[model samples]
Target: MNLPVMRVLLAEDDPHDAELTLERLAIAGLDVEGVIVNNEADFIKALDSGTFDLVLSDFHMPGFPGSEALRIARSHPSALPFIFVSGVLGEEHAVDMLKEGATDYVLKQRLDRLPIVVQRALDEARERRSRHDAERRLRESETYFGQLIDALRDYSVATLSLDGTIESWNRASEWLFGYPAEEVIGRPGDMFNLPPEPGQPTERPLVERLAEISTGTSLAEERWLMRKNGATFYASVVTTAIFGNGGAVRGFSRIVRDMTDTRVAADLLQMAKEQAEAANRAKDRFLAVLSHELRTPLGPIYAAAQALDLRQDLPPECRRSIELIKRNVEVEARLIDDLLDISKIVNDKLSLRLEPTDLVAILNGIAEIFREEAAARHIELRYTPLPYPVIVQADPARLQQIIWNLLKNAIKFTPRAGEIGITMYQPMPGKIAVDVSDTGIGIPPQALKRIFDAFDQGEEESAQARGGLGLGLAIASSLAQRHGGTLSVRSEGQGKGTTFTLTLDDPAGGDVQAPAPVETPASPSTHRPATILLVEDNGDTAEAMQFLLAEYGYEVDIAENVAAACACIDAKRYDVLVSDMGLPDGDGIDVLRHYAPAADQIAVALTGYGMESDVRRCLGAGFAIHLTKPLDIDHLIDVLQRDNRS
Candidate 1:
C-alpha cells in the first residue's frame, strides 16, 4: 500500500498507550494528524468540530469508553471508522463490538499493527461509496428508459431474447396485444396463438428467425398476429439486433403496428373507384343509344310533312294522313324522354320534389293512362282498391314515373288474353305495398340474381320477343331505395306468372283528404292554322320540320341561322316558335332570349342533351315545353295544337 496522510482521533484515558500508538503509526510511514481525548466532554467536542479519517479508542476511560465513541461515530452522517485498542478485553467482548459495526479491534499491546489496520479500513470505505453511486445511476437509467417506452401509443414496443422469449413488453404492447407484462414476460412469442396455414405446424416460428437476428441480422416484414381472443390482424414488424459493449450481438427489439383496418379501407376505396368508372361507361353507352333512337323517326315525319306542304291540291284524307305522322312522331319523342329519365334514376343523378302523395290516386291515374295500351295488347289490366287510404311521403312525378314504368312493363310482357293485376294494400300499419303480377313468361332462377341490375334482361322467350332496353326494373329499384323502400320480384321460373312487389314506408300521420286531380286536355280535332318560325342548323332536319308543320295547317317559316330567325321574329308575330338547342350562331336559349317572345306565345326546346339538368335549365329559361330530338311528331302536334287555340 502507498503511504498517505491520515487524520486520526484518539480517545483514551491512558496517556502511555496513546503515545505508543502514535509512534508506531508514524514509524509505519503514515503522515499522522492525531488528537488525544481522555474525557467524554473533550472527545464529544473534538468529534463534533474536527474531521478524522479514522478513530482509535482505548477500551476503557475514566469518563468515556470505546463502545460510547463507536456509537457516536456510527450515528454521524459521515461514518468514521472506529478501531478498538484494548489490552484486557475478552474474546467474546471483542467479537460483540466487531459484530456491532466496529471497523476493527486491536490489542493495546499490539500497537505496531495500528497503522496497517487504519489504512485498510479507509480504502474499503471509499470503495463502498463508489459502488453506491454506480448503483444509483443504473436505477435512474432504467426508470428513464421505461418512461420513454410507455409514452408511445401508436405502436406496441417489445423485445425478445435470442431464444424467442419475451424479455420486455411496454404499456402500449400490453394495451394492443391484450396481455399484462407479468403474463407474457417469460413466455415464448408464439404463445399468442396466431393463425396457422394449411400444413404449417406453428403460427409464427419466430425462434428460427430470431437465431439469424441474434447473429447481427435485420428483418422487416408483415405478418398476421393473433390477439388474446384469437382474432387475427395484420401487423408490420421490424426487428434488428441489439449490440453489447464490444459490438457483439445481444438481443432484438421489435416494433409492430396493426394494419388490419388500414388494409380494409384501401380495398374498399379501390372498389368504389372501379364502380364509379363502370357507371361512367354505362352513361356514355346510354347517351349514344338514346341519340340514335330519337333521330331515327324524325326523318320520316319531316319528309311526309314537307311533301304535303308543297302540294297545294292535296286531298283531305291525304292531308289528314300527314297530320297523323306529325302526331305519332311527337309521341315517340316523349317515350325517348321517359327512357332517358329512367337512365338518370339508375345512375343516381335524378332529383326528387318531395310532397305528400296519395298512392291510390296515382295508381288510378296510371291505370287510366295505360288502359289503351293494355286494350291494344288485348291484356286485361285491373287495379284493386286498398283497405285504407294510403298517403306517402314521395315525389309525385317520380311516383307517377315508377307506376307508369311498372304498368307499361306489365302490359308489354303479357300476351293477348293475359291477365294483369295491380293491388295496393297496407302490409303494416305504417307501410304500403303495391304488387303488380302478370300472367306471362316469368323470370328464370339463374337470371333472377341480376334482374335489378341496369341493362340486365331475362332469358324468357316471351320477354325477348317483346324486347325492351331492360332499364325499367333498374329504375324502379333505384326509386324504391331512394324512398327508403325496396322492390323485389318473385317467380316460379319460366312459363309461370311473375309478381313484382314495391313496399314503401308511410309518412308519419293519419289519413288526410286527397288532392283534386288535374284532367288531361281533350284531344283536339280541329287543327287551327297559325304563323310559326323554326330555327335549325341541320338542312335535312329543318326541311323536314317545315314541311310537316305546314302540312298540319301551320304557316311555317324556317331559318337555318340565328340572324335569319331573328329577322323573321322581328318582322312577323308567330303563334309558336320551335328551335333546335344547338344552332350555328348560338344555342336555342340565345335565340329565345333575343326574340323575347310574349308570355302567351309558346316556345318549345328541342335538343339531344336529355339530362335532368339540361331539361330543367331549358324550362327555367321560359320555354313552354322541353323536347329532345329526334322530335316526336305526335307530341309536337299536341303541343302545337294546344298553342294554336291559345
Candidate 2:
C-alpha cells in the first residue's frame, strides 16, 4: 500500500534527451521522480541539493563533461552513481571515460540499453546504502550499551564464560573487590570465594540453573569474598545465564552487591536490642521493690483507720475524720495501682477477660461515678440512657476504665459551669462511635500530636493544678488499640473546646440475637468457720489482719517470721495459710512447702510485691489465690469462703 519516492538528477543539455531519459527510467521499473539540468551551473546546483539517488549525464555536454559530473558526485558527502549516455563518443573514448569514473557507457544508437544499465546501477547503490545504515546503527547501539554498563557503581556486573571464568568486569568490580579488570578477567570467578561452612555440601554456585525456571529469587545465603589485601567482606551475589535462540548457553552475567555495611548494622542492632531487654528487666525489679515498700505501710494505715471507723462510742467528728483518712488512703493506693498497670501495659502484660456484655449498662455506671464530681465543680454532666441493651464483645472492666479516664480528664480541665457531653450513637452499619466532648481549654496545634504520649501534658500551666501523671489518655489509647478499635481527639483551639471519640468495629449488629447464657459454679452451702495462719513481718499489719480475719469467724494465729509460722503449723491444723512473700527467716514459699505436704489446706499469698510476674511466682508456689496488700476485705472474705466451702 505504500511505496518509496526516489529523486533522479538527469544531466542532459538537450530537453528532448532529458524527457527521453525519464520515460526510459519508468519503463525500467524504477519508482523515480527526476530533476533535469542543462549546464555546468545547473548540474553543480543539482548535485549540491543532495536529494538525488541516481545521476545520468551526457558525456560531451557543452561545458560539463560526464567526467566532471562524476568528480563532483565523488566530492559530495553522499555516494551518487554517475553514468555516460553520449552519441558522439567513440568506442575507445567511451572505454576511456568508463575507466575514469563513469558507472557504465551506453552508445546513443544503443540507447535501448540505458534502462537496463540504469536499473543495475540503482540496485547496487541500494545494497551499498543498506550496508552503511546497518553499520551506523551497530556503532550507536555499542555506544549506548557501553555507557549503561559503565554507569553502575553499586553493582559489580560482569560477563562470564560458560566455565565460570570472568570475561569482563565493570568499574564496580574494581572498587568492590579491589581488583582491576586486567587482573580479574580470564580468571575463575571463584578466586574470591571461601569454602562453605561445615555441614554444608559443596556445589558449583555460578552454573546453577536458576534463571531457567525463575526470573528472580534470593540466593540461598550470603557468601564471604576475600579482597586483594587478604581482608574478607560479605557479598550478596546472583548469576543469570545468557541464552540464545536454541536455548544454548551464551556465557553468563553475574551481579554482586556489597553487604558488609548491612551485616555490620544488623550486629549493632542485635546488641542494642539485648541492652534494651536488660534495661526492662532491671526496671521490673525496681518496681517490685518499690511496690512492696509503698504498699506494706498502707496496709496497716488502712486497717487502723477502719478499726477507728467501727468504734460505736467514737464522736461523729472523729468518725468523719477517719472516713476522710480512709478515702484519701484509698486514693493513694489507687495511684500506686495505676503505676503498676501502666508498667504492665508497657511490657505487654495487660490481660483481658473478653465477654459479650451490655455496653449501655457499663456506660451508665461510669456516668454515675462522676456525677458528684461534676456537680461539685458547678459543671453540667449530661448523658442519655439507652432504651435497649447494646451488647459488645469486650473486656467490661477495661472498657469502663477507658471511659473513666476520659470523663475524669473532662471534669478536671473544664472550668466551673462549663458543659460536658457524653453521647453514644451508631453512625452506620458495622460501626459504633462514642464521643466525650467538653467546653474546656483545648489543645494547641503544637501539643496535639503528642497529647496521647505518656506523661505529656497538653496544658503545661495546668499540669500541677490538675494533679495527674498524664498517663490516662495514653492508657486509654493503648486499650482501644488492643480492642481492635481507636481513640482520637480533635480541638477547635485553646479555650474553644475539645472532643474525644472512641470508634469500634461493630460487626455484631445491634439487631443480632444474643447467645444463650451459661451456668456458673454455685458455692457449696455448708457451715464452716475456717482457721487462718497469718504470716506477716509488720506488727501492725499482722495484728490488723488477724483482727479482720476473726470478725469473719476465722480463728487466727499470728506469725511474724518463718520459724514462728512453721511452729504454729506444726502445732495446730489450719484451713488457710495467708503469708507475705518476704520474711525474716526465709521466703513465705518455704513455709508453704513445709505445711502444704502435711495436709490438704488452701494457701493464699497476701504480699506487697504486686507485679504480674510476682503473682505468677506466687501461684507457682501452690497458693490458691495471690492477693496484693491494702486488701479489700470483702474480696478476701469472698475468696476465703469459696475455698473453705470447696
Candidate 3:
C-alpha cells in the first residue's frame, strides 16, 4: 500500500533531534516532508509561508517552548494537528502542553511511538472536516425548503408524519384551513376533512392511508373540508409520499385547492345554455305562425289579379293597375322569403340543390324582371348578354335570388336618370365574374367595412325612404361563400357609385359568347279532363281557386274544413286533391288521409308554412307535391294539366 504524503513543520532547537524524529516517522510508514525551524521567528515564518498537514516540535527550545508553538498552530482557520517531541520533559510540563491544544506528546526515549500518535491526530482531523461540511449542507437545504414553502400562497401545503400526523404547516395552510401552525401541528391530518353525514360511513383511518402511501404512490380526493370555525367548503386534496436517502418513506406532503367557486360557475353556465335553447325554440314557432297569417290573404288577391290579366276586354289603365298590384304582391312574398332564409342560415339548416347552371341566363332573367320598374323610376337599366353561356355549379333559384337582391338594391338607391349596369366576363381562366355597378348613394368609408352585417343599413335616411329589413346583402354574401365564390364591393366615396363584384369558379365545357337558349312554353295538356277537390279554409281563397280551376277545364268541388273535405270525398270520386296545409279544424294532411286516393290519383299540398322541415313533413305524409303561397298560378295550372296515366 502507498502511504499518503504529509507536510510537517518541525520546530526544534537541536538539529539532531529533528532529523531523528523525521527518520522514525518515515520508518513507521509515514511519508514526511519536513521543514526544520530552530527559532520562534523561523517557526512562525514557516507556518505563514506554506501549507502543512501536521506540526512537530521539541518541548523546550533555547528561547521558545512547544506550548507557544501549539498556541500559534491552533490560531489558524483549520484544525491543524500539533504534536510534541522532547528529550527532557516533566509531567507538569506535559500536562501544560496538553492543555495548550497539542495533539499528543512523545519523549525522545519513546520515539518509536511517534508515528502512531501522528497518524491518530491526522485521522481525527479529517473526520472532523467531513462532519462539518455535512452539517453546513443540511442547514442550507432546510433554509431553502422553508423559503419555498412560504412563497406558495395559492395552495395549502402541509407535511405529515409516517402515521399521518401534521408535522408542519405553511402560511397558506393557516389562511385556507383557518388554523394557526401552533394549533394544527402534531394533530391528525384528517382533521381538515368534514365529518361524515349522519348515518354515513366514516372516512378511512390514518393507518390505512399510511399503508397505501408507504408503497411510494400518491392519493387524490375531492370533497367537503371543514375550516377551524366549522364552515365547510369544497376542495381538491393530493397526498404524495416523501422519501429519505435510504429509499424509505420519511413522511408525506399534502396540497389543497379550493374548488367551490369553479363548481358554481359551471352550473350557472349550463343553466344559461338551456335557457338560450328554449328561447330559440320559441322564436321558430313565432316565425312559423307569422308566416301563415301574413301569406294566407295574399293567395286570393294574387289569384284575382291573374284572373283579370287573362281578360281580353279590359282598358289599358285597368290592365296597368292590375299589373302594379301583382308586382307588389310578388315583392311582399320575397320579403317573407328573406326573413325565413336568414333564420335558416342562423340555425345552420340552409341546404342547396346544386347543378350545373347557366349564370348568364339567371342574370338576364332577374334584370328583365326589374327593367320596367327601373324605367318607371327614370333609371337606365343596362345589360348586355354574352354570346356564350357562363356555367357554374350552383342552385338555380338561390343564384337568381342573389342577383335579384343586388339589382333591386341598385334600383332603390340610384337617382333618376342614373345608369345601372350589369357586366359579366371572365376575369381569369376558370373564374367567372359579374360586376353590378350603379351610380347610386354610395356607402360611406366607415360603413363599408360592416355593410354586409345583418341589419346594418348604411345612411339611415335612404334606408328609411326605401324600406327593407336589411337582410339582403348578408344573405347574398353568405350564399356566395357557400357556393365556393366571393361577393365584394368597392366605392371611392359617397355618390361616387358602388360596384359589387361576384366571382365564382367556372368548370369546363361552355362555349365563350354562346347564344342564350330559347325557352318553349308548355302546350295545353292533351289528357282527359280530370275531377278536382279543393280544400281551403278561407272563403275568398276557396272561391277564387274554384273559379280558376273551372276556367282551366276541370270539374272542381270546394271544401272549407276537414269535415267538409271528408264529406266531399265520401260523396264523390275525384282524380286530383288540392288542399291548403292549415285548415280550420285540422291540417291538410288529415284531409289527404281521409281522401285515401288510389294509385292514379294525385295529392298536392299548398300552404304558407314554407320552412324546410314543413316541406319534408308534407312530402313524408305522402303528398305528391308541396307548394308555398302566394300560389304560383302557372305552376298550379301545369300540375293540373299533367298526364297521370301511370
Candidate 4:
C-alpha cells in the first residue's frame, strides 16, 4: 500500500504559505515533496535545475508575481503543471492567471481545493508526454523506411496515384530514368515505355495492368522500355496495388529491374538445348545401326553351336565347350539389350503392358530361377511368399526384371556362406513392401546417398571386383517410379549388410482369398516336319540356320535376299516362310507381301532389330511370330511345332 509521490516547485515571498500548501497536498493522501524559492532568480533557477511534477506560486511576492512565474513555467520544455495559491488573488486576477498558462488557481482561503487542482494537472501532463513520444517514434520510422528505399541501387521504385500519375520517386528511379524527382512526380506512369510502332497497340498499357491488379493484387511482366536518351532495353517490372487502412484502393507501387543481359543469356541457353536434343537423336540412330551390325555375326555363331549340340556322338568335352559358347552368346546379347534399354528409358520410349497379376507368384518364380546361381556361390538364398495372392496392376515381365536385378546384386556382393532373404509384407494399409536383404559388405555412409544414381558404383573394393556398368540400380529405380512405386535402400555402414526395399500400392488394400493355382501344360514331344522358305541377307547366318532347320527334320530352302525369296515364293507354295527384316534388296515386309501366304500357311520374321517399334512392324506385316537375333533355337523350334499342330 504505497501512495504516489508528487514533487512540487514552490514560489513564495513568505514561507508560511508554502508550508500551508504542502500540508493540504499531504492531507489528500499524496506524498508531497517541495522545493521553496523566495526571489525571481531562485524561482527561475529552481525551474531549470531539477524535475518537478507541478509548480505552486504566491500571487504577490517581493518584486515577483505568480503571473510571471506561470509564464516562465509554461514556456519551459517539460510542460510541468502550474497553479497559483495565494490569499491576495481576486477572482478577476485568478481568471487571468489560468488564461496566461496556469493549470488552475486555488484561493489561500480555499486551500482545501488545492489537492484536486494539483492532481488533475499531474494526470494531464502524463498524457501529453505519452502522446509526444508516440509521434516522435512514428516520424523516425518513416524516415528510416524512406532511406531504405533509396539504398536499393539496382531497382527503380516508384509510387503512383489512383489515376496512374507518378506521386513519388526513389533515388534509384531517378538514376534509371534520368529524371529528377521534381520532373517525374506529376507525370504519367507510362512515360518510360517504348513507343509502339504504327498500327500496333502499346504493350500491356498501364491501365490494363492496373485493371488486372485491381482484381489479382499484383502483376509481373517483361518488356522493352525507353531510357531518357531514347535507347531501349529489356526490363522486368512488378506492380502491386496499394490498399488504404479501410481496404479501399489508394495507389500502386512499381518496381523495375534491367534484364537485357539476362535475356540474351536465356536465348543462348535455349539454342544450346535445341542443339543437344538434335545430337541425342543422331546418337540414337547410330546405336540402332550398331546393334544390328553386332548381332548379325552372333546369329551364325549361336546357331552353329546349337547344331553341334544336336550331335549325340560328340565327346563330352566338346559338348561342354559348345554349351559354354551358347551361354556366353546369350550373355553378350543381354549386354546389348541393356544398352538399348537405357536409351529407351532416357528418351521416355519404354512402355508397359499392364494387367492385374499375382505379385506373390511372380516373386516366388524369380526366386526359383536364382536358387541355383546362389547355391554355386555357397549363399543361402531364401524367399517365402504369402499364403494368399497379392494382386497388383503391373507389367509381369518388367516386374520380374526389376526383382532379378535386385537379387543379382545381392548374390554378387555376398561372400561364401552368406545369407540373402526376400520378404514381402504390408507396410501399411493400401501399400505393399518387398525387401531384399543380404549379409554382404554394406555400402559406405557417403556412397549410400547416391547409390541409385546412374553410373555411380560405390567406392568399395568388393564392388569393384564384381564388374558392371552400374546402370542396373539406376534403371530399376526409374522403372519403379514409372510403375507408381518407389525403390529405397538402407544400410548401417560398411560391413553391416544392406537392405533394398521396393514399395507399391496394394490394389485390393487388405487380406484377400487365395485363388486356385493354374498348372501349365507340357509341350508336344515331337514336331511335324514342314517345308520352309528362309530369307536372310547375311550368308553365314543363312547357312547356319538352314542347316539347323534341316537337322530339326524340316525341308529348308535358302534365299540370300528379298528378291530371291520372292522368286522362290512365285515358283512353289511353302508351309512356312522365315525372313529377316534388313536385306540387301528390301526388307522382309516386301518378301511377305510378294509371298502372299494363305491363312493356313505361317510366316515368321527373324531380325537383329528388337525395338518395340520393329516388333510391331513385323507383326502388323502378317508375320505369325517375330524372333530377334541372335536367335534362341529352342524357342523357335517350339514355336514352329506348336503352330504346326494347330
Candidate 5:
C-alpha cells in the first residue's frame, strides 16, 4: 500500500527542534522529507526548489525569525502551507504570527501536537485558495454582464424586486425615462410616473397587480404616462409577470414608447381622407342635378311628340304641338338655369349675395313651388310661420335654394298621402331652427352615419330608393355651414320616419330691405341681328348650332378648331363668340386669350366637361356663360338674344 507523502521545509538555527518535529511527523505514519534552513535565505532557497508541501519553522533564529520564513514561502508559485513551530515564543506572540498569515503554530514543548497542527494547516490553505478562486470568478462574471447591459442601445432594461422596488437600471432606461441609475435604483416603480395613475401608487400596487396577472385573472393595459416635467404622452405599455424557479410571482417588466407624433400624423391623414370623400360626394351631387334638369325638358318634348303622332285632325294637332313646343322650350330654359347654379356652387365661384331677408317669405315661396308635386302625391306640405316675421341676415336666393332642396327631398321621399311638416321657431334668443319632418321611409342606423355624404344612398337595390345623387343633403349642409348654421338629421331607424333640423344665426342688428328684381325688355323677339362666331371640333354639333342660329335670323360664322377661330376673331368683330372648350389645336381658353375681346362682347363656352371647376375656369378666362352638352336649344336662343341687345 502507498503511504501519504509529506515534504516539509524546516527553518531553524537549532537543529534539534527541527529533527524532533520531523520524527513526530514520521511517527504519525506520514512519510516525511525535510530540508533544514537556518535563516531566511536558505528557507527561500529551499522553497524555490519546489520540493515541499509545507513550511515548519522556529519563531526566532540567530539572524532571522519564523515570520520572515513564512513570508518567503507565501511569495512562492504555490503558497506553501506555513506553520510556526517555536519554543522561545509565548502564546500571544504565536497568535500574532498566525494573524500575520501564519497558517498555524505549535509550541516546541508540545511535540506530539506538531504533526496534527501541520496537517490541519495544509487542509485550511487548500480551502482558502479554493474560496479565493471562486470569488474572483464571480466578480469577473458580474463585470461581463454589466458591460453587456451597457452595450444595449435600443431597449431600456431594468429589474424589480417582488415588492415593486427597482433593483437594477440599465443605461438605456436612464436615457429613455430621463432618470439616471443612481436616482432610480432602490426606488418604487411609481417614482417613474407610470400608470395606474402617474406619480401615484396604484390602488393595488404593482406587486399585487403582478400577482393577479400570474393567477390568470388580469391583463396588462397601455396608457398615457406623464413625464418628469408633467407632459402627458402616449405609450405602448406591456407588463409581464416574472417567475421564480417554482413558477411563483417575482415581479414585472414594462416597456413603453412615445406615440404622440404618430397619433397626430394618423389623425391628419384621416382628415385628408374625409375631405377627399366630401369632394367625391360633391361630384355625385352635380351628376344628379344634371340628370334631373335634363329629364325635365325631355318630359314636355316627349309629350309633344306623342300628341302629334296620335292626332289625325291637322289643325288641332298643330295648335297642340305649338303649345307643347313652347312649354318644352320654357322647361329647357329652367333646366339650363339650374345646371348653371349647380356649376357655380361646385366651383366655389358661387358667391352668396347676403342681405336681410324675410325667412317666412322664402319658406312660403319654396312651399308654393313644391305644392303641385305634393298635391299630385296627395302629401300635405305646409309651412308654419314663426310668431313674428322672423327676419334673418342671409342671401335670399341661396336660402331659398336650401329650403327648396329640403322640401323637395321631403316630397320625394314621403309615401303617397304621407304628412310633411315644416316649422320655424326660435329655440333661443339668438338662434332660429327650421325643422322639416317627414313621415317616410326613415334612415337606418348604419345609413345615418354617412347620410350627408354625397352620392351615398342607404341602399341601391331600387332606383327610387336611391335618393338624388345624395347631393341635396350634402349641399344643404354646406350652405348651412356657410351661413354660420348647422344642418343635422335624426331618425328612429328604418321605417320609423326622419327629421332634419336647420339651425341658423338670428339677425343681431335691425333688418334691411330685399333687392328688387331687374326687368328685361318686353319683346325679346325684336332683338338686333347680331354677328356670331362658333368654334367646335364636332362637325355634327357645329352644323346643328349653325343651322339653328341662321333660322333665328342671326349672321353665323363657324370654325372647326381653335386656330381657325382665333384667325376669324382677328379678322372680324362679333357680338358673341361661342366656342367648345376642347379643340384640335388647343382649348377654348387659348382661343379667348388670342381674341382678347372687349369687356362688352359676350364669350360663351360650350363643352362636355361639366365639373364645377371646369365652368369656373371658363368664367375666370372671361367667358360670359358656360354650357355643358348636349345643348338646350331654347336657352342658347335666349342667351343669343340677350347678347345681341348688350
Candidate 6:
C-alpha cells in the first residue's frame, strides 16, 4: 500500500540526475513533492526556507559544495533525512558522506533501485516524527496531572521514590510543610517528621507504613505529623504505591488532610462551659458576702434609730422624723433581702416555708407598710378587702414578699398623685386572686411579654425613676409559682395603666372567714433586768445593742469576735446570749459550741447571714430563734420579754 506524500529537497546540479530522482520518488508507493537546487546559494536557501521529508544532493555543486550542504543541514534546528544521489562518487566518498548525517546514497546508473530507497528513507522519517509527537504529548500530560494535584488546597500531595526519598512535591504539600519543591526534592521523605512527641511509638513509623504499601496497595492512617514551621498537627494520610506494568514497585503517592480545627473547636466548647460555671460560682459567692457586708452595719443603724424613737423627751416633730428614719431603714433592709432572694431563685437554691396562710391578712399587713411611703409620693394606696378572708396553704413570709414587691414596683412606676389599689377576691372556685392595679405609665404590647424577665425594666428611665434593681417582679413571679400560684400582668397598651394579679391555690375548700388583725405594737411592757452576753463583730452594732438592751432593763456584756465571745462565756454566766452568726475570727456558732448554755437561758441567734441554709445550721447549732438583720429590735425585745415570762 502507498504511504502518504513526502516533501523532498533535491540539491543535484545536473538536470538529468534531478529529473531521474524526482521520477523515481514519484514511482515509489509514496507520493513526493520535490524542490530541486544545485548551487550553494539555492541549496542553502531552499534548505532554510522550505520544509522537506528528505534531502537529495550530489558530490559537488557549482558554487555550494556537497560537504558544506551536509554541514548546513546538520546544523539546522530540526532533524531532516539527507541522501546522496551521485553516480560518480567513490565508495569511500559515499561511505564518508553517509557518516556525515546522510540517510543513504543511491547511484543514478542503478536508477531502478530508486523507488525502494526513497520509500525506506521516507518510512524512517515518518517513524521519527511519530516518536517525537508521542514524547511531547506525554510531557504535557505529566505537567497537567501534576498541576491538578498541586491545586488541591485542603490536601498535601507528595511523590516519593521506592526507597522513601521524595521525588516531587505539589504546591499544597509545600504550603502545608513550609518547604518548597526545590529544597525538598531528592531528600528523604522523613524530613516531614522531625522529633516526634513523647509516647510516639517507634514500632510503625511513616516510613514503615510506606514500605508496606510498596507492594502495590494503599495504606491509610491518622498520625501526629510535624511541619517545617515547627508545628505539630493531627493528619489523615493515605500512602499509595505506584506500580509499573511489569508489576514492580515504581514509587509512592501521599495525600494528607489536616484535622486540627474540629479538635480545637470541641476543646474550646468544653473550656467555655467550664468558664461559665466558674462565673456562676463567683456570682453566688459575691452575693453571699455582699449580704453579710450590707446587713451587718445596718443592724446598728436601725437599732440606734429605733432606740431614739423611744425617747419621751423628744418633740413630736423629732419623734416623727425618727419614725421616718426607722421606716426608710426597714425599706433599705428589704431591698437587700430582695437582691439575695433573686440570686437564690436564679440559681435554683430558694426554699419556701409553706404553712396555712390567710392570703388577705398577709396582703393587708404588707399593704400597711407601703401606705406611708405612698402618701409621701402623694399616691394614695388603698386595699379593698374581700367580704370574707381567703386562706391558702402557702409560705406566709414569701407571700408577704410577693405582695410587697408588687406594691414597691407599683410605687416606683406610679407618677405623683397616681392612685394604687389592691383588690382581694376569689377569681375562681379553687383560686384566690389579689390584683394590685396602679394608675401609671402602661407597658407596651411588645414589652408585656418580657416584663417579668429578670433584670428587664421594660420601662424607660424617664418614665420611672429607677429605684430597685429590676428583679422585684421576677422574684414575685417565681415565688408565686413556688406556692402553686401564678402571677401575671395586664395592660391596655401604652398610655393606659397596668395591673398585676397574683392568683394562689385555695387549699381550704370551706367558705372564707373574717380576716384576722395583722399586728399590734407590743404594749409598753415591763421586763426584769437580765444579764446578757451580746456577741457582735461590728463595733457600732455592739455599742448600739448594749444601749438598746440597757433600755429594755438588761445588763449587756458586748464581745466583738468569736475569741472575745468565747472568753466572755468562759468568764461569766448570763440569762441570754445574742450572737451574730458571721464573725471576723470564726463563726458565731463557735461560741455556742464552746459553752453549752442551759435550755432555760435563751440562745437567740443574731445574724446578718440570712439564707435558708444559714438559718437551718443556726437552729441545728442550738439557737432558740434565727433573727435576720437589721435585727428588728422591737421583735427582739418581744422575744426577750416573752421568754422571761415563760
Candidate with top TM-score is 3
Which lDDT tens digits does candidate 2 get at residues 527-562?
Answer: 567788989999999888787777767889999999
Could you arrange the candidates by TM-score from highest to lowest?
Answer: 3, 2, 4, 6, 1, 5
The lDDT per prediction is: 0.78, 0.82, 0.86, 0.86, 0.74, 0.82
Model 6 Cα lDDT, one tens digit per residue, 1-646: 7566788888887888788788876665457888988777887788779888788888777677777888888888767887777778789988888888888887888877877777788779889889989999989998888788878988999888877888988888888888889999989877766575599765455567677777777888776788887898878888899988898888998888888886678779989989988998787778767888888878888888878877879899898888878878887888778888887888788988887777776776788778988998999998865566677888888888888889888888888989999987677787778889999888999999999888788866733567567788999999999988899999998768889999887776547666677766556546557899998878888898899889878899998888988898889988898998878889878888876878678888987766667778999999989998898888988888788766
lDDT of 1 by residue, 180-287 (tens): 899999888667645577897754477777777777778988877888867788888888888989987777888888888987897799999899889876775677
Ranking by lDDT: 3, 4, 6, 2, 1, 5
Model 3 Cα lDDT, one tens digit per residue, 543-587: 877777777788899999999999999999999999999988999
TM-scores of the candidates are: 0.53, 0.65, 0.77, 0.61, 0.46, 0.58
Candidate 1, residue 641: the lDDT equals: 73
Q: How many backbone clashes does candidate 6 have?
A: 1
Candidate 1, residue 518: lDDT: 71
* CA RMSD of all predictions: 17.0, 7.4, 5.8, 8.8, 20.4, 12.8
Give the lDDT of residue 470 in candidate 4.
Answer: 76
Q: Which stretches of candidate 5 lie over 4 Å from their true place?
A: 1-152, 155-365, 378-380, 383-401, 419-426, 442-450, 459-468, 490-498, 508-527, 539-554, 630-646
**How far off is residue 578 in model 1, in Å?**
2.2
Worst 10 residues of 5 by lDDT: 295-304
Mind sharing the TM-score for model 2? 0.65
Stronger candidate by lDDT (2 vs 5): 2
lDDT of 4: 0.86
> Which 10 consecutive residues of model 1 have the lowest summed lDDT?
508-517
Write candidate 4's Cα lDDT for 491-519 as tens digits.
99988889999998897896795785685
Q: Candidate 6: which pairs clash?
A: 40-64
C-alpha RMSD of candidate 6: 12.8
After best superposition, candidate 4 residue 87: deviation in angstroms? 6.5
